[model samples]
Target: MRLHLRLILTVLLAGFAALVAAGPAAAHVVPSTVLQLDVHEDDITVEMTLPTTDLVTASGIDVPVDGTVPAAAAEQLAAYVEEHFDVTIAAASDATSATGTWNVDVGDVATAEVEQWGTGAFDAVTATATLTPPAGADLRSFTLDYDAILHQVVTADVFVLLRSDSSTGEVEQTRSLGAITLDTVTGTVSPLTVDLAGGSARQGFTGMLLLGISHIAEGTDHQLFLLTLLLPAPLLAASLAGDRAGRSRHWREVAPTRRAVRRITTTTIAFTIGHSLTLALGALGLPVPQQPVEAAIAVSILIAAAHAVRPLFPGREPLIAALFGLVHGMAFSTTLSEMELSGTQLVLSLLGFNLGIELMQLVVVLLVLPPLIVLARTPAYRPLRTTAAVVTAVAAVGWLLDRVGVPTPLSTAADSLGSVSPWIAATLWIAAALVLLGTRGRRSGIRRVVSA
Candidate 1:
């Protein structure tokens, strides 16, 4: 119990730390302005998220509170944004580098009610701006001269973050540059200087690797589907003498360790191959029907769960694993697609992310499967496997219904599985250890009795 509590607390603390570390400047109780920059070879694009109340207070544009801006006010808002925001090249350390201002274009003024993490719901205005440097100016390091809301609302803070930089191989990860706020003691706003470091292909690949690992770590549905299929891998399949379905089979005695290991290895590799093919295709702009793919993944889990109870495809677990892996890969592709990567960056991301997924998958199997193999030889195996399969099947059905546009309490409960998964893993480890110890003790007693 102490171990379980420690595991749960560790997970919760890590999550909290992540949220806090995301934006160091965003620590105020009230809403703050957020500015995200997308760096390219020749230019940078700025995405501005302005609190509606602060925008009106700063520019006096008469914006409405109902999350709408009038046509006249929208133009005024765009002009106001253009007037206050500017990007300039940073001076070199040697004092020999040229400096110039970039051309700024602000458009697509829109308003909506957005709920930011930890800040709840608030009315906000969002706009996109492009900053293009002069013919030979550096785009990596620059001075941001922005005072949209802070000019009037002295207490308002603005967080500057790097959203995507292809040259730096920073796709799918956000880096905080710095914050633009008034110096309380000096009571003055200074220009924000953003200096981004150089990056190589290796860095990009590593980033994708971490992304893939985290994706699978947090993706409970994907983990469940794969784990459930491996549940019956240690047992042999026997033909039921008078089965209704002619091809039906049931799980029987435990297979030799070597056979079980062989089956498990083949199934895992097959799954990897299956998903890798579709993940590449989907990342390369293949159209993936999101809802149907998600639903199909749930259906795959359902089939795997049923197989765990009664062997649906006795000797062909690898083939089934591969087939279902294709659906799971499509779901994985959605994450990369949202990153909006292209060319070399996209290719590298594909490699890194796939590697990450495989590494995490292997770790999970190593941690849980060996214990199950030991347990499979014991009398308690049948009941344990059935309970796991039934629970998994229920979660699958809940997810299936939810993905198809129906909501249920079962679906909500299934979502909580990820939070409790660490505890579950801990329990499995302890159980396996106890089982091994008990078996060893029994063997020792029998040997002593024979000697006496």
Candidate 2:
């Protein structure tokens, strides 16, 4: 009896030590599955990412040596995921009604190696699926019965994220819904009940407004294009001597303050109209070829810079600004097109985004134009304008070359110009102030000499 008791105690002590040793490893284990959901008008899109090693273990699908999912394995993986994943509602109409199951169509299986924290590097399988609720059923409040890998690998976890829901005012943002893990106490996996509340139109509009503000604020090329066009707003165009039919012209004198302000206003308004028209059409359904539009924008800036040095269109700056604004508008529409919003949300977003853009444009004009007008009155303005135009032309050429797939150091340096723009604006203001002070001192000295 004594020997038996000693043996039992020894075994119990060894088991406790093993449990203590395994605790750290279990704690350090990273989640193996991720589900990103995008809620649209009529359906939800699910992007599932799973570890390839665990996926093979759970679904018995073959993983190729090169880490790409083979044709046969891709089909098998899709079918296995379809079998394991489901979405349903607890009640169709009322609390006591029967549960309604959502239809899920899975496809687009792809494989790649991904890195995860605490798990090091591992091969991952990604698949896309569309989840559609039954006719007349609520999509926001549904039960997600997903068990792709966790159904077999009991220790695995699946993280669910709401990637974008236009109605909820979420665009290009990720929100964590919850995680799906086995309940150790019950020894079973439960469905995650997603209850997304109804979102207001105001919320969506505000989100789009902020998005538009940031878009303009961060878009250095766009800022350069607009500012470069406005560089000669205060200068007057005059015909060159010995030129027949008045074809050749140059920026020879400063315009009246009233005339300059009016010209700036007209050009800015024309640009707004041009971009707004294309932005609406493009967001509605028009296809915009992104590359050409971008390259054309760079070309617009180059033309503007050249015109700043020597009047190209002369008095027709508004028309030119409007024409180039059409190209810029198409670029702006790319942001909204990716959101996939529809109906009232789309309308509000359009208004909010345009308003945000105009607000920023107004702020920029207010900050930069006053100093430019003051500097334009000074004799030093000639060299200042020419130097600025030359630098702008160089940057525009760099962007044009880079956008066309020819990368160069000039493009990188041009991009860095946005970071130091504040300093440039300050210098312009200081120069204008000094020129004004010097002019006042000269006038005072002349008055004193005449009096003497």
Q: Pick the candidate with the highest TM-score.
A: 1
Off by over 4 Å in 1: 1-29, 40-43, 60-79, 93-99, 105-109, 164-175, 182-188, 244-248, 397-413
TM-score of 2: 0.76
lDDT of 1 by residue, 1-452 (tens): 23433443454345433432343234334688998888765678888889999999999888777755678888899999999998887865225255568899998888887755666678889988988987677777778889888889988999999988765556557778999998787877899988875777887788778878987788878888878977898899876788766576779778998998899899999999999999998988889999999999889989999999998888899998999899899999987775667888888889999999999999888977897788787766676677678777888898899999998666776766676667666766666677788889999999999999
Expressed as tens digits, the lDDT of each residue in 177-235 for candidate 2 is 99999887787889888987777789878877877777677787888887887789989
The Cα local distance difference test for each model comes to: 0.81, 0.80
Model 2 residue 10 distance off true place after TM-score fit, in angstroms: 79
lDDT of 2 at 269: 97
- Top of the candidates by lDDT: 1
TM-score of each: 0.81, 0.76
**For residue 56, what is the lDDT in candidate 1?**
90
